[model samples]
Target: MQNREQLWLELPPMSPEAPRRLLVFLHGAGSSPEAFAPVALAWQLKFPGAQAAILQGPEAHPGGAAHDWFDTRAVAADRAERAALAAARLAQRVAVLQQSTGVDAERTVLVGFSQGATVALEMVRNRPGLAAIVVAYAGRLARPIRSGERLDATVHLLHGEFDSLVPVVHAHQALRALHASGTEATLDIVADSGHVIDQQLIILGTTRVMQTVFRGRRRAAGDGRTLH
Candidate 1:
């Protein structure tokens, strides 16, 4: 087992002893925990009672100084297998995080971007109960869910409308698949957005986290479906 403690930038809660939720963020490919520091800081500031942990990828990027969850280029056959291995490791890390922070699965929110999002989805599928909500941006499902598989989390997929890299269609596909499998999932298509995260998307994600943590507001009145 890997020493997962050395793999994160842990941000403690602002209000000590007040029940805190855990926010675990996984960065995109070729990025480090440092690269995501600003986002983590913003999230902490927005929700001071929430504990944040920005994690680094397990493997070094072949191109240079950054890191990757799994190989993106070449080895088409083993891509899914490799991604699954990475997700399993992340699951272990999440378990450690929950134990250390004293936060339960329902109060934990797992977040990921791009390749990280792929791994987050896989983590939920392979090892459930890490979180009740998953915020995946610019990513897709790692593999097809087998028949009778169950996903207990509420997944929120945010994708840029003009994303050429992964394409918005992937988000749609994930939403459909998750719904078909009886998973609570929603998709938010950002207009005029590209492959990057913007302020609007950040606010949206933060709001969702608040709603989940507080439980004051329901998912609208009439329909159970989220409109966004």
Candidate 2:
């Protein structure tokens, strides 16, 4: 299995005052929270009062000190079913976390890599508006979304052009799917890269986040203006 790695992680959302932003990060298959904390923290730094969580996958992946959200060896149909159920469970977890952290779905962000990315996308696919944004790295859409479903969050898909494991085509296909569903989304493919996250990818992801956050604020402001 491919091993992956991410920093002081402060989960102090339980403070008397609720945080304004919530970030939930998920590592790839055969990875743990300890391996993805740094990446999660990187995003948190951009959003003040944003509490972050590097969540561990629920199941143990055999032959390693890693965890998986669902079985990867199952047949395609079975794997899809398993992933959907996993996403459902995760959505529930997010709801509870939001209540405790005082972060509403509109202020929440979900970031995941590879299989973790699949689950993150799946959850929002099942719910349509579970969080305000999802930043998927080197991952594809695991389940089919209904046509023209109302997407409450914008999705950003980032992939490595030379990623053999997940292939860049998946990102293209996912973007198409999201577009057909009337969801606000974007895709960025990094050249000369593989399945792993590197400095270039990190910088690219940060740029996407900044653009989306600011654009959302502008739209919200426009909506609040009085019409003549």
Candidate 3:
């Protein structure tokens, strides 16, 4: 992991006792750390006593009023390269924080939206055991994943079926890659949503994590499904 520094907002654990879990949040492209704070808080509230952190993208978005994890102007493959760089730095930060909080990688939960979500998935693409679970929304796989590629994180991909910016097809493609890599993953498509975040999606994400990450249960099957 790269040792480059990244900005982070820490929300101390609700309890002073030793926290066993760490939650990390990343915002979408052209979105700020503040804009994603509420989503982080909601997840934290659902998982009591877990420490949480919100990471801000390093550069400002060219469009203004926000930030981006990588340069969007770059071509498809180049964009993935940029996202990989950002993911390396963010992974380093998370590792350092985990040491301080006494939370191991298996107890870490990484969540992100859009661009941030891509980087979140990238974190575990080649590095197994970085995070126990990853919840990515409205994001595509930045890198090509081959069959049997090492990945220990159980990923939950959530997307809007009608998403125009990043078509739901991207999520389906990612799921296929994940499956080929023999990774444990799931995809949920919301029927009545677009590119934007929907409350129902958020609820589904948290619920999914709570069921598998915390409760150690498995869903019936490993196929993608549309949610009404």
Candidate 4:
């Protein structure tokens, strides 16, 4: 698994200037960082001030070629354990990226789908002060994590109305948990959608994160006026 972790990170192209914001994407089960290339490209174009980097998960797929954030074997029985393991691995990767790119921890956002979403939430919950925002799609939080802890960032939960894989009910439960924990979180449901990603939903999700980052910067500037 250590060697697998070393091989997991293959960063996409990026520029300097501190990257007004950084989006780190964690791919779902059986998928690689490549799966998020399209969305990263779209984000780069749509949010010029932000840069996107997709990180492959640390576990290799059984009898296959790619990597996964967590071992899916016992996910059904002990998802919280798997999520915790993945979150620890993701924290290492994020630390590496932050050290190399000189990006502020508060300017970084974590986005994921399916199992990837579970990993992202775990990372944020465990490392509360690092990430600026979290965007989770078609996923929920693992159990045993307290729902009364405060977070330094915001969270966005997106789930499909017809997602059979990870039911939308779980997503709502995660949202409620986050709120109970005193974290700022918003949940959005896509009508008639399934487990797959929707173009409009991606746009909406990414836009919300960008808007939050932009608004924060404006507030920090102390101009007494919102950027809008």
Candidate 5:
């Protein structure tokens, strides 16, 4: 269970009243908000004007003292329903953040790792357009997304080719599911990588967020240039 004293870790934006983007990060099983807070902080440097929130799972991870979004030991059939519930709760949390920070769904991004990614993916089904983009690392769908339940946000699925913990096949399956549902999804396989987030994945995530956040915007005539 989450420690009532510390529910989440947050990196406030440089400008509380105005910010360019927001990132919501979810940690893997047996992990706490602390596990992903560093990366979330580092993103401030990478994205320049973004705030980040590292959310802790509501339930305690069965493996240890860390937290988990859903009980990993639950029957496979029940896992999906549990994940759906988690998604609903998380959407409410995100709404609070959005209201307090003024970062709407259009300017926010959802990023998750492993089991956390599964819950994030579930959120896409539960609340479409909850964010502009979602980046899932070393994760897969806990259950298949049904037809007519299309995800509205752009999704980037990254997995290590040599990831033994989750296996790369899961990424492929997720890609198929998202594509079938007509979501804008991309599957990027990192060669020789393991079930871990590396510099490459971080850069890719940053770039994707920037791209989605700035897509279709017109720059001023005098503007030198932008990465996009």
Candidate 6:
């Protein structure tokens, strides 16, 4: 049971009329919410009508400096257990954040990198009815969620062609599992890129996905559908 006291950040919208879309960014292992500050700033600027929240991981690392969403112990040995714990804990934190910020689950999008990507995937799997979209960069789905579970949200997997840390194969494996489970997913390959998300690619890919989600929401809203 991880403590929830240290797991949240609320980045308010620039305007009251800003779109209800909430983008949450999850950082990789050994990184804090500040790691994604630049990307969040860019998103806030580009989508001035949206609010972005970057959540810190729960597991604190050595030096009491950085955090991880889950204990990395036996990640390779017992990934299912690790992922399940992380998913449950993260879902709880997300629920609290939504209540505090007044963000609807159906209007929320999750974006993560590296280990953070794994956490996002698990969160989506645990609460498939929520999350409008999931954007994973240089990460793959945890095996627990890949085992025949159906994911309701659209997934965008962005991977480098030569990512030595996580490997391109991991992305392919996740895609295969997603397809087999009938999940809606789209995979984008960044040519000549590496483990780190390039600024240009992040802006391009994230903006495109956000636009798609907003468009769909608008269309739904026009149809007199309450997106809750």
Clashing pairs in 3: none
Residue 78 displacement in candidate 1 (angstroms):
1.8
Tens digits of per-residue lDDT, candidate 3, 1-228, equal 122544678887766554458999989988887888788877777776788988888877896968888889867668877888899887888888889888888689999999889999998875677898999999999878865585789999999989999999999999988888788899999998998777898899989887775344233233343211
Q: Give the per-residue lDDT digits (tens) of candidate 1, residues 1-228.
A: 236434678888988755578989999999989998887777777777789999889788897989899988868788889899999988988898899888888778888999999999999998878788899989998787788987988888999999998899999989999999999777888899998878888887777766664552354434564422
Give the per-residue lDDT digits (tens) of candidate 2, residues 92-210: 87787789777788888898899999999988888866798998999998866676675678899999999999999999999998888788899999889999888778777778877
The lDDT of each candidate is 0.84, 0.81, 0.83, 0.77, 0.82, 0.78
Candidate 4 has a TM-score of 0.87
lDDT of 4 at 173: 87
Model 1 steric clash pairs: none
TM-score per model over all chains: 0.89, 0.88, 0.87, 0.87, 0.89, 0.87
Query: Which consecutive 10 residues in model 5 have the weakest lDDT in total?
Result: 219-228
TM-score of 2: 0.88
Measured over all alpha carbons after superposition, the RMSD of each candidate to the real structure, in angstroms, is: 4.8, 5.2, 6.3, 3.2, 4.0, 3.0
> Model 3 segments beyond 4 Å from truth?
1-5, 15-19, 214-228
Q: What is the lDDT of residue 180 in candidate 6?
A: 83
Arrange candidates, best lDDT first: 1, 3, 5, 2, 6, 4
Q: What is the lDDT of candidate 4?
A: 0.77
Q: Which residue window of length 10 is worst by lDDT in model 3?
A: 219-228
lDDT of 4 at 29: 84
